[model samples]
Target: MTASPPPADDLSPPPSCPDAAAPAPAQALQRLKVAPAEQPLSAAQKKFNRLLARVNSLERQLEQLQQSADALRAPHLQRMDALRQRMAQAQRAMAQLLHARLQRPGLTAAQQRAVRALLRDLVHAVPPSPQPEPEWAALRAAYPRPVPAAPSPEALQQLLDVLSAASGETLELSDLEDAGSPEALIEALAERLHAQDEARRAAAAERRARRKTTARQAEAQAQAQDARSALRGIYRQLASSLHPDREPDPAERERKHALMSQANTAHERGDLLALLRLQLAAEQVDEAAMARLGDARLQSLCLLLQRQVGTLDRELAEAEARLAHELGVQVRAADPRRLLEADLQALQDELQNLAEGMEHDVHALQDDDKALKAWLREQARLAREHERAAREMTGFGFQF
Candidate 1:
């Protein structure tokens, strides 16, 4: 076979070794694959690094959160701040409403009195707090608070107008309803009576609970006092036994000295329970109360708190009085304390009136009930007499 000359290459240079410059198509493909293979791995490494960074950030956040939670474990000023804020908000709203009402000219002085009366009535209906303040504070800590409803736009405007008219001017009214109208009076009396009854019941219940708490505290205090008295007796006995002066021996003197020191320390520290335990170990019992008079921690704390409250109350009162003096002529205007006192006075009056009205109502109801019972008894007696008469007529064989 004739060997044909090799066909001339067209439109391209001769293929070069991939190691030099140009590469075969297969080698080029392999090179491209190598870079992509590295790319996927690099992407995975980047993702892993991001994941590690996120984990580290979360760890830091968790540690911070733990520290914050631990900080909240103690009672904090923030709680007091929040309470004061809420109280301030309520006060501001009340002051604004009053100011607005005072600005309105159309409202009469009596209508204003009536408005105060309504506010007075409503404030009393908030119910008396029977529990201790600390207990109430604790309950408030856990309990969900009620959200106040927003007033309707029209009602808000009306309130604003009424408040504006009420400021600085006197109110006057006419067409007063007759106080002697039985139906109207009865309805009013009934409502007042019911409210009064509730208040009395509340007061009585409070008095009872307070008595129980006081009794418990008193008993606990008595026990502690007795323990302390015993401690003194024990101390006297121990001191007699451990007197360093009585010990002629040097080492025994040192030992007695130590015991005496311990006894003194314990007595001064008021470790009555420990002292009592020591007394029991001594195999001789003394009348705890007869041993000596002493103090109780619970009673002491109660006294301390009472004194603190009294002092704080005096300070607050003085501050308020000074403020009032400064605003003497305008004390009623913008006096937070005066408003608080007025509110309190109004509530007391309402509660007293309601209680009296209820008592009267209850008495009246009881009287009516007694009258009805008497009438029933009379009717019953008449029926019996008629039956006897019928029986007597039958026995006499007479037809009427």
Candidate 2:
């Protein structure tokens, strides 16, 4: 077969390869050049930097608060589990007691009714087993059928109102009717009580605010306002400094764009530290002049710092209160790591005691049951003997 001729373009000479070690393009080199000499940071900029440091410190405080919250959460959850287990143990103990009481043979109809009434009195009694055996029949007769229906919204609201009145706290009226069981209703009522307590505290704060402010309080309020103004001024300065649209060079514009985005985010989040860091990185602030802030600006910064610290403290307090509420315990100076251990131990101890009591009760019940059975057998034997004696007497035709 004849080989096809090569294409015209394929015959052209290939281009020579450059040295692997060649320097980058001039444009890239220009891009890599160091930025222009830094300008001195203005008085306002220095104040901003100081405020940013305070903000960063506050952020760290918040982080530590969150960590404490997490630490508290684990123990609180363990305590809750312990409580649940305790409840289950209590239920099991009660069940065993009921089973023991119900196991007595030869119970009359009236006696069975009385056992059932006792079982019915227990609100959280367990359901009976479904076997046709005699032992199970007694238990089955005693187990109550508490097939609960969902409460109507109006009735739920009424119940919530009553609970709220009894608790002396505002109860939230939301989806409470969906509490499908009585136990769930109780839990919902508990949550509402907690919410109400928080609401009442807020109201009390409002009431306290109605009181005349002392001179010190007035001065502090003014300082707080000044701190807020200073923060706003610093944020505006950062925003103006990093306006990307004003940058003439594309590379500088790109850099400004990123910085501006960061500034915007920091402003939105009130993150003074991030904005200050961006300014420092961009060489917009003069480090040497950062310490040259005026006395007035320094005072303002101090006020800002005070306000920030107070805010952090308040947040931490709220977190602690929330944790305390979840654990159903007062957390006054309590270590977050070990807060729930005591409660859990107490509950476990209670459970142990309950279990022991139940065991004792079960043994006593079994002994009583054995005695009852023996007595019933004896009574039955006596009845049979009496019948046989009567039959012999009747066959002999003897008149009494």
Candidate 3:
């Protein structure tokens, strides 16, 4: 059998034996496929992933906050409007009672002073009549409205100094002397501020234009281009995979169409994270692939995400500010909805107490003269204290 051994080219054993057809060692090795080892994320890549996760969390939180704010706004506004109406009615009733008491004969000097003080407080509360009643006109003549003191020269100069320092321009009192009243001064200051703002904006624009032509700007442009390229690459991959036209099934095509729309929108907005998420959704890329991205690409993505984080932060701050302004309360960041609800409840309670107090005052003032006189004496004493305090504030150069 050895003398009759097959030639080198015919080395295979006969097919009659099961072991004769077994593969050679090299052939068996070739058939066993070994997967390449995944590359571990570098420090920068890990940082980028952390930032991405933070952005995702912020996006969800902001959306939820906005939804909650929207849901609370209508009810809050409605309740506020109702409370304001009640307050107005209570104020009108109080004003009418005071006016009637003032018209009565033999009122003590203290009572008269208290009535006038109450009337002055009601200036904003009571709607002005186009035609004054005889009694009201007489009452006005007896106790003419007090003229407010003008802003002192020192105060005006101080304001000018502050404005000059802030605006990087010289502001003299003579420039705003024509602004006699506080309201006029405010209007003049607003105009000056607007002009200064415009000047600053123009200067900034010019500086930006100059910067755009510099080497540093060129580097920035290059970096921006790289970031855009990374974003476009992900968007393109998503587009290719999720294009509805490529899908055969109706349901799959519709789904693809939706994803394609989302991808398009994300691309238009330069939302790199959103496009990357779309890539994940379509199975065009995985976390491992993302981690394996080149350093330059990862850096660009990180920069984009950093800017997104800044924008999200500003949006969150602005949203909270708006909510706080609307609710007339400071919004707590940790649990804004709960805090807003608590503040709203407190405000309702306060308004209720005010309404009840006003009602009780009306009844007391109408029925009991002795009680009313005692109240008037106390009010007059408080008014004197307030006037003294005002005089003291004025002495220190503070204006009302």
Scored by lDDT, model 3 comes in at 0.69
What tens digits encode model 3's per-residue C-alpha lDDT throughout 1-400?
Answer: 3556433221112222111122332332222112134755576667676777667667766777787778877888788777777776677677777777777776878668778877777645544557756655564455566777877888878887887786667867666767765457667778888988899999999988876387887888898888777777667666766778877789778878877898898888776667665554555544345534566767788778887888778777888798889877776445757777888778877887887777787778885678778877777787799999999999999988
The candidate with the higher TM-score, 1 or 3, is 3
Q: List the candidate numbers ranked by TM-score, top first.
A: 3, 2, 1
Each model's lDDT: 0.43, 0.56, 0.69
Positional deviation of 303 in candidate 3, in angstroms? 0.9
User: What TM-score does candidate 3 get on C-alpha atoms?
Assistant: 0.72
What tens-digit string does per-residue lDDT give for candidate 2 at 109-163? 6555654554554424433335455644454455756567877878777887887
**Ranking 1 against 3 by lDDT, winner:** 3
Off by over 4 Å in 2: 1-61, 71-86, 99-122, 125-226, 241-290, 327-400
TM-score of each: 0.19, 0.42, 0.72
Best model per lDDT: 3
Cα misplacement distance, residue 59 of candidate 1 (Å): 46
Which ranges in model 1 have alpha carbons more than 4 Å from their true place?
1-81, 105-110, 115-237, 240-262, 265-273, 276-400
Ranking by lDDT: 3, 2, 1
Native-to-model Cα distance after best TM-score fit, residue 294 in candidate 1, in Å: 27
Task: Supply every candidate's count of residue pairs whose N, Cα or C atoms clash at under 3 angstroms.
Answer: 23, 0, 0
Among residues 3 or more apart in sequence or in different chains, the pairs in candidate 2 whose N, CA or C atoms overlap within 3 Å are none
